[model samples]
Target: MEAAIKFEAHEEVVSFDQEGNVVVNKESHMSKKLMARRAIEAHRERKRLESELEDYYFEEM
Candidate 1:
C-alpha cells in the first residue's frame, strides 16, 4: 500500500535536498513566497497613496 499525504495551505511536498535547498520537479508546480511579498507591498503602497490623496484634497481645498 502507498502512503497518503495531506496538503494544507501553501504546503506541497515536492522535494528537498539534504542541505535544505528546495528541489525543483519539472512535473510538479510549487508555490513561492515572492508573490506574497509583492502583493503585500503593493497593497501598502496603494493604501498610502489613497490616504495621501484624501488628506491633500480635503485639507487644501
Candidate 2:
C-alpha cells in the first residue's frame, strides 16, 4: 500500500536576477527542516497504523 498523498519538495523562494540566475533564499532553510520533520512523523504514523491493522487481521483469522 502507498500513501494517498505524496509530497514533493520544491524551491519556492527563488528569484531571478538581471542575469537570469536562480537565487535561493536563506529563510527557506528552516521551513525545509520543519517539512522534513513532519514527513518523518507522518511516515511513522503510517507504519504504526499498518502494524495495528495487520495485528487486527491476524486476530480475526
Q: In candidate 2, which residue pairs clash?
A: none
Model 1 TM-score (2 dp): 0.47
Q: Give the per-residue lDDT digits (tens) of candidate 1, residues 1-61.
A: 1233333334433444686444444433334464445445655666699799999999998
TM-score of each: 0.47, 0.51
Superposed model 1: Cα runs more than 4 Å off: 1-31
Give the range where candidate 2 is weakest over 10 consecutive residues by summed lDDT: 1-10
Model 1 misses residue 9 by how many Å?
Answer: 27
lDDT of 2 by residue, 1-61 (tens): 2342222245444454676444445556447676556556655666699799999999999
Clashes of 2: 0
lDDT (Cα, 0-100) at 33 in candidate 2: 70
| TM-score of model number 2 | 0.51
